[model samples]
Target: MITGDNQHAAMRVANHLGIAPELVFFKASPSDKKTVIQKFEQEGEKVMFVGDGVNDSPAMAQASIGVAINAATDITVQAAGIVLMSNDLNDVLKALAVSRRTLRQ
Candidate 1:
């Protein structure tokens, strides 16, 4: 996860999510998020970026799959490939599951 937040906050969220500390990018700007996605693409990785703030629009557009919450800014909504109707973050997992199932079919 790439975020503009400081290392402490970033680590806190990462730890809660069970993500590796090395995988978290702290003090990242929107452009930094885009760069991270680009780097992942260069490494042959598929990225799914989820965000809501206006600050997230560029990164959202840069992701392999961009997901936005319904309450996000218009710009974010426009940039996303998938916009969740509900603000619940768990819906992202559901969407991922459905996509995987569809792909298998």
Candidate 2:
């Protein structure tokens, strides 16, 4: 997770989600988040970014696939390829499942 939140707060949430410290980036500016996604793309990684804030727009536009929550800022939703109507992150999984099923046909 790349977030503008401070390290301490980010780490607390990360730990709860069982995310490794190495994979968590805290206090990242919008540009930093976009740079990280660019770096991953350069390394041949397919990145899927999920966010719901104005600051997340740049990175969201940079990702291979951007998922935005219903509560996201207008800019964020505009930047995303997929917009979830629900606030729950679990909606992302549901969207994925739907996509996979549609693609199989």
Candidate 3:
């Protein structure tokens, strides 16, 4: 997982998620997400982006799969292919776990 931040709160979120500071690319622009997505796409990786902010809309739309909370802004929800029913992070985690398990099967 990678993260970037223009604010301390953003950086703190990354840190809270246990993402290494080095792996977290902090920046003041949404272009950071675009750049990161481009790199992964260039590497032939299928990328999925999950976000609830307007700033994340562009990159999320660019990704192979975009997941957004139902409670997110209309722009974000519209850009995402998957609209999560729950606003809880734990619900997201559970969905991911289920997906992984199903894939393993």
Candidate 4:
């Protein structure tokens, strides 16, 4: 998972949900997102990016799928393919579960 200082609070929430700190890559610059996405794409992995901050909107738009919470900024909501009504970080796991199920079908 890719994140930024702007999402530190949310990352803390994600950590509570069992997403390890090692899995989280925190970037302070928006430019870092491109490199992160590129690296994932190079590995042939489909990456879903989620965030509520403006700095993350770009990566969100470029990701295979973007999830934005209702509490997020308007820009993030606009860029996201899935706009979650709930703010709970646990909802992200639900989304991933749904995606996995759909893919299997």
Candidate 5:
């Protein structure tokens, strides 16, 4: 999880979500987020970026799968490959499950 939020707050959220501290990037700028996505892509990794603000647009566009929440900013929605109509973040899991099922078929 890469976030523009402060380190302490980002860490708290990462902990709650069971994300490892090494995987959490705090105080990240839009460019930083994009760079991270690019780096992962260079390493042959597929990145899925979930975001809801204009600041997230660039990174969203850079991701292999960009998911926008229903309440996300217009820019974020435009950049995302998938838009979740529901406000719940758990919808991301649902979308991934559906994608996996489709791929298996």
Candidate 6:
């Protein structure tokens, strides 16, 4: 959960989501986010970046699967491979499930 939010806020959100605090990157710049995605790719990991802000465009574009909410900035929408029309974060899981089903066909 890489975010531009401050460390304290990031930690709080991470804790609530059951994500490790060490896995939460706080105060991340756009470049930093992109770098992290690239690092994951280098390590043979597939990254799925979900974002709504203009600042997230770079990382979204760098991700293997970029999902943008319908309410996201134009740049973010353009950078994403998929857009969630409902603008609900949970829709990401639904989308992934559908994709997996489609892939199995």
TM-score to native of every candidate shown:
0.95, 0.88, 0.74, 0.75, 0.94, 0.93
Off by over 4 Å in 1: none
Q: List the residue pairs that clash in candidate 3.
A: none
lDDT ranking, high to low: 5, 1, 2, 6, 4, 3
Better of 3 and 6 by TM-score: 6
Global lDDT of each candidate: 0.95, 0.94, 0.78, 0.80, 0.95, 0.94
- 1 against 4, candidate with superior lDDT: 1
Residues 67-103, model 6: lDDT tens digits: 9998899999999999999777889999999999999
Worst 10 residues of 6 by lDDT: 17-26
CA error at residue 44 for candidate 6, angstroms: 0.3
Highest lDDT against the true fold, candidate: 5
RMSD of each: 0.9, 1.5, 2.5, 3.1, 0.9, 1.0
Model 4, span 39-69: residue lDDT tens = 7878898888878878878888878888898
Model 2 TM-score, 2 decimals:
0.88
Cand. 1 Cα-lDDT: 0.95
Model 5: colliding residue pairs: none
Candidate 1 residue 96 Cα shift, in angstroms, is: 0.3
Kindly list the per-residue Cα lDDT of model 3 for residues 2-104, writing each as its tens digit: 4454657667887798877765666635677877887888999988777888988888888887889867789999999878988787777777788889999
What range of 10 consecutive residues in model 5 has the weakest lDDT sum? Answer: 85-94
Model 6 reaches what TM-score against the true structure?
A: 0.93
Per-residue lDDT for 26-56 in model 2, tens only? Answer: 9999999999999999999989899999999
